[model samples]
Target chain A: MTPPEPVETRTTTPAAGRSAQTATLAEIAREAGVSAPTVSKVLNGRADVAPATRSRVEELLRAHGYRRRRAEASRSPLIDLVFHELESAWALEVIRGVENVARGAGLSVVLSESAGRLTPGRTWADQVAARRPHGVILVLSGLDESQRALLTSRSIPFVVMDPAGDPGVDVPSIGATNWQGGLAATRHLIELGHTRIGAITGPSRMMCSRARVDGYRAALETAGLPVDPALIATGDFHHEAGYRQGLELLRRPDRPTAVFALNDLQALGLYEAARELGLRIPEDLSVVGFDDLPVARWVGPPLTSVRQPLTEMAEAAARLVLDLGREEAPVATRVELATSLVVRSSTAPPPA
Target chain B: MTPPEPVETRTTTPAAGRSAQTATLAEIAREAGVSAPTVSKVLNGRADVAPATRSRVEELLRAHGYRRRRAEASRSPLIDLVFHELESAWALEVIRGVENVARGAGLSVVLSESAGRLTPGRTWADQVAARRPHGVILVLSGLDESQRALLTSRSIPFVVMDPAGDPGVDVPSIGATNWQGGLAATRHLIELGHTRIGAITGPSRMMCSRARVDGYRAALETAGLPVDPALIATGDFHHEAGYRQGLELLRRPDRPTAVFALNDLQALGLYEAARELGLRIPEDLSVVGFDDLPVARWVGPPLTSVRQPLTEMAEAAARLVLDLGREEAPVATRVELATSLVVRSSTAPPPA
Candidate 1:
């Protein structure tokens, strides 16, 4: 294992004229044409302030780069963990990881779901700012410009875990080696003599899903196997999508003998699809999945999957955000932990 | 569906001579021989309070049944959700349920795990008191006397979800009909012509687990079958326990034709054990499980099990706690939601 290499690029660059010196609360209030108490109320997330005054005060605070003192910023003994959605066993793994770190640090975890939205709503940001938690960790979720600015103005650091979209160069993040995981999953199938391999991709918007499919393509190209577009099916990283797409791929007269699913949920769906089609695993079809969730081992035929360290990644993300909160220096760190393939009963040589 | 019955038993009883009137803060401070500010600090869970003084003041508060005014109680727009352990998909389901209610109420959730401890530690109690959320929801976790006094002093209402222990008659709790679930699961197997049936039990320390085993025994007795103590295996409600105990049960020369696992995870473990023993599900051995988790349907031969509405139970618990916080009246509520059998592919007539 190699050490984490420091990239030349930073996560976020400060606006021009940004410096060690920052404007005071009174100065921000004067610029916004509001009283100091009104400015304080806005900062405290009190709902009494008018919307117009609050917006103006917020803008001035951002423009002046007003950050509360470290003592004032971390009043609550909390670490915030936000998720795109709380579905499946995946969220549980990440929550446990964050909880582990928070407990060690003598801090509690504040959990929230973006409720299927890619970004948390504005009210969430306001509540987070008001509570003044030590740091925030986002899983498969990102903040928009204003939301980022809001947290930045208050000096509350945040780190993303397995970013769904490219979370800008300036945002610190922790992710798994999804590309390598995809390559390993495909190569294992190739080694098992499956030239005609089908691939099921996660949501197109998620970079992790895209990386896996790209790695699958690279493996096929490197191994002198044709990358048939027809065999590739799109999925939302859900069981239903996997079953639906798996049926489509399997029904073809020239169906692939093996499939690589983006995640374990999809792989289980593929298992169901194969069962409905009267196809025996290994004998009629071999399957590989990513994110070796606990159910992977318990499934029939025991899924062969790429193991992404989700809990470790969450721990890293939490720790990184806390570190960012402590240090004055900007750290543009993006760490990708290693991923490896686990061979089990699910994968075998394709039938002749 | 029957309406929730109002039990004659109340959760917590006030001490003798309790009345509508309560001791003033100044009076309590005078009695504890501390300054008003110092007494206030203790109420706020400040670390600066001397341990002896804090304990003395806490005893007075409990004796007087001092309850903070509702106006001063709910300062934070948050709800505390404590778990016994955040280990499996089960926790995720409960989290979602609480999150749903919290979101609708415009409140965020503060999640903490007791880390396998039946009750949260003193530190957790202090933190919850300081935060002063709208209410507290304890999932399979309860508060001790002192911890209860601390919350009661701060007027922080809490409701237990599926109490791990007896939880006393005075604690408001929401739980599933565990005995009914067990009966349904075992009866399903019995109806399938399995006279010789094996049972897996969760930890006997937990009331829910004990209820399940008792229900299993009741089913056997009602069927006029001899209760064979040798056929019942004890587990800790985990997959590994299921596998270990399952092996012990299956290895017997006169092994029962069917097995009823305490939970879905253990049932999955039983599947693995049967696979290792070269026995096919339903064909060679019929199985039934409780808590129809999503994986129950996705697993091979889709488990025939009892559906415990874990999410609904969590939602109900959260709402009940919030209701308790709002009303001045003490609610002696213990709701047990219905559980039903969900028969799928895992159960069938015992093989000849």
Candidate 2:
């Protein structure tokens, strides 16, 4: 944080001609035949400058006011956010949310993926510990006792985002209201006079998937209808899985009149399956999806879906992690954002 | 790295065991009432462990033959990959490429975005310096003199991918043949018997954008056709830009028989424009786009496009950066992957 060192002044020194008073580098741009930033780059000795341009700017600098000041706190304050994967719009949505908040706070966000492993490798923890980020956000990820201890011992706070598995009572977490979303979707179908409904749930082990299934049961129970095991199926939350599973559902002789897919990807797959079977959506069968990603609108019939506040939840998680690092910020154990039903073109009354 | 310290040898001493032979930890998982990873965690002494589970796993460890070995490396070797933005599928494709290679190499990939700025902020370089990654791969990004110097001083190598502007001759980089991609896309339009072809160009300042426009010109020249200056329009390489510009192009009294969009996003926008004008694709106006993104296949009446080898380019860039970090590896100045034309359902002979 010291003042810039003096440079070799030439015969064209501003002190001789222009008084050198109020000689900001930007003023020098007019005389240097370059942009102000180019002049600034020359002043700071940035190497990206072409050698010829460098000399011209340096010549102008010799006759003008140019000073380079050391930036306070040379070390950057960054947040480490790790996911199991990144090649999806869902991950992008979360990244946008974190970046929006981080940028406003003058902090940069760093992203990493654990290569789709069920648990992160020990090396990831080791690097995070060494980097000593201000805080960490684990998306659909959790730390084992050792990794948690490593970060805790370093006084670095971390939060779980949409925990894939139970993060336990002690871990701070942020998630959307999965059960409510599922309940709302099912109720919409029931209100449309659809009692024979089918469901495609995400991986049973994921907390959100389990809660959504639970919600489905809750809605059915509230309607005084017994849950049918035959009507429930499992999906891997992918288009291919949805297509295969949807085909299976459609092929059944007693197939339900409506299908509820847990995610848009799977619902799109169901659409493909329905097309192959010559069954039009909302005409012979009504379909609903969750997550309400942008693709929902792009699809042919525009699926009815449950809108999960993914971005808002991500923002909340990011803020919570940063707040946990602040001494005065009260830490909440759990945060649940709301989810609601978005009724679009895909759902209607079941077949006459 | 050092050998594991000797543990307490109370009742479960290995010397007092019934042949502590062939007792791998995986074997211990069956008897310990826990996962193999949990046993490994106990062995690693990670702090996130519950006392009860730790004790149970420890008992199984002592009863069976559980021994700890020194890990070859405590910290993961991470490579920094920076982008201008992550909200697009183009970014995701690059990520997938880098992750694919990094994972196989037993290295993790850390992602960062410069918030769409031409150059990353000073803190980004500081953080990378602090982390001391294996190397950095910047996509459509560059470093100023100081940031480059900081990395070079630390012996941290970096390579640019699809550089936005001319990288100094000294820099190693990987990119697709953008000019060729543009040439192919435009040539396809001409081959469709479209004499009055219009085009939407990407941002004029970007290197790829300029190259694509140049290719368009070259293609028209090769076909012995005069390039129309008024028929060419500039875009921000986004959907909205395409929609707005497409509308302008479509509204012209001498509207083109066909239009070539610079990217798939812009092509989708053209679809929107055509829809708004009640014009059917391939019948009223032909459209061809560059960057055969996945959406190109899914759009109504799939689009014909130039396929830039984005994933392969990214993989090459990642490997190049890592290679630059190796003391014995020779550096290549620049690497250009090939681009090809993918003809699908959207294109046809200019509205017959």
Candidate 3:
């Protein structure tokens, strides 16, 4: 590994020390025996500076290293990072991952939430466009047709993470294999001798939620187990929604012996519901979750979850967006990351 | 109670549906009988466009209800959010808090890391200044004089979070009362009838670690107990570090019956170390933690911890930075938020 480079501090530079208390344009003009506006024009690099005056000012700037600071400020680079929302802890890791890559690339990442006040209107687009970012990385939860159209219309090179649509408009995308992860989770429960398995999934409209639901169904069919519609419930991917669905599922006289939640937040809700219903995990009912976030290992009975390579995913997403900015032609690419099941204490054989 | 806002969507208006697909700049230009560049310039509000051309384009835009996709890219309304490092799930909540306030103010946040390639330099400052952000929020573990000088030289308004200096600096700051929280945690252990207490603290260089250590010392003195330097061990605020410290402390011949970890991550490490030592929480040893992160509740024995309002701190930081941007003069503001101790299963009396 390369040795960590030293951080450059402005104070250490000799030039900064000389101009530590440098005067303004008026002061410079007075010292140069010229008008303030003339000094301003010369400083701003505009034309019409007399040779004698320009030479004198140039000499002064060289003496003070004043021109170096102005030149440095003028050549600043811009980087923009877009997110669907910053409401969850998961986004934090993603932000860190992007920051790491951006910093490594010697770029500054401008953070924007597409779902925030700057909705896909001229106002929003204008505000973002004003930044003139070199590239943009969009962490989209889901984009409606208009938002997608608007983004495409701007012709800004962008990479999307967990995009809702096909991203056919030529933006690169990075996402986890939600369907396969879902299948593996459901299959794990089946292998553990669970016949009646239920699922609490996210909003069906989200591509990820739909993919997971599909995987759950496929697993049941592969095992020759009937896919019961009643056993499938939809949630907003929030703990409260999962808790509500969990309570409803447990209330059934013929309740499923196991449950697979699409996300850890939902799984936590299920745990709460299980506690309220006086049911013990694994012993009374087995539970599995996806997106084995940091809390998965800390949760009681350690949640058995499908771990998504979040850091890797974030790094890949950042790289994709940065690359997109550099490419002229629209590059439509999709990277599907693999997932693995972490078998913890949350899962066990069905109760006899 | 305020109703939750409706989620934004992008359905096209029925009247503009067909036109949106077929309409192009060429078509608009043809309709107005102007050249493509002229039409573009007029639409973009370039001063170079003749008044007549501008008027015509304005009329056509309103008449056709034309929705231009993205605006012409420029530079404005940018802000950089800098973090020292990213390691925990709790950082997500803080990011969300910042995003929330930033979005509301129509300012885009740029994410950057302090220790990476984008460290304080002409390059980093250039990158940030290129986008021309209104202000910046630096989320540092601590700030040395050199780092402070860098921001001052850049002439950018910034608000520091969890900083290590006197808030007498020219910038605003927001931080949790780590010292008070530490006091609360230690006092709780004292109230629980524990005479012998130990501590696992984070790196002493951090303001939080130092503050917490001070609080612990104050509590011990208040309880008329001699402060035992041997009973305290330093960790890197990570689980493994905490675990190692826990093992060392527990293995000591004069091991204290209770341990106060400066943060939840350390407490978790201590928990694991205790388990490895075949000791049950609150029975063999009681442990208290600071920063009652979400994982604190999920641990096997729910952690008794001091809760820092992370989200609130993040919001305040955002607000402070934005406020700084709007002001012409430098303002030094310091905000100290309070913390509370939550009693959970992890704490009890000393063993007989």
True contacts kept of each: 0.66, 0.21, 0.49
CAPRI grade of model 3: incorrect
DockQ-based ranking, best first? 1, 3, 2
Give one digit per residue, the lDDT tens place, for model 3 in B83-196: 766668666667777878977876677776666322345455445533445667767543444444333322346787877444454457898998999899999999989878
Candidate 3: C-alpha RMSD to true structure equals: 20.1
Q: For candidate 2, lDDT tens digit of each residue in A276-321?
A: 7999888988999998876576555668999988888888888988
Better of 2 and 3 by TM-score: 3
Error of 1 at B223 (Å): 1.1
TM-score of 3: 0.73
Docking class of 1: acceptable
TM-score of each: 0.94, 0.72, 0.73
lDDT (Cα) of model 1: 0.86
Predicted chain A of candidate 3: TM-score: 0.74
Please compute DockQ, using alpha carbons, for every candidate against the native two-chain complex: 0.42, 0.09, 0.19
In candidate 1 chain B, what residue range of length 10 has the lowest lDDT sum? B1-10
Model 2, B1-352: lDDT tens digits are 1112232222222323246434566667667677776665554434456889966766655454443332223222677888877666788789888877887775666677798886788768856754556779998889987677556534567888888888877788898899998888888889888888889998776898899889989999999999999999889888888889999999999999888899888888888788789888888888888888766765556789999988999889888877766643555659888999999877888766
| Regions of candidate 2 where Cα sits further than 4 Å from its true position | A1-76, A103-110, A189-197, A217-231, A251-258, A277-286, A299-303, A327-331, A348-352, B1-77, B104-108, B192-196, B282-286, B327-331
Give the lowest summed-lDDT range of ten residues in model 2 chain A: A1-10
TM-score (chain A) of candidate 1? Answer: 0.93
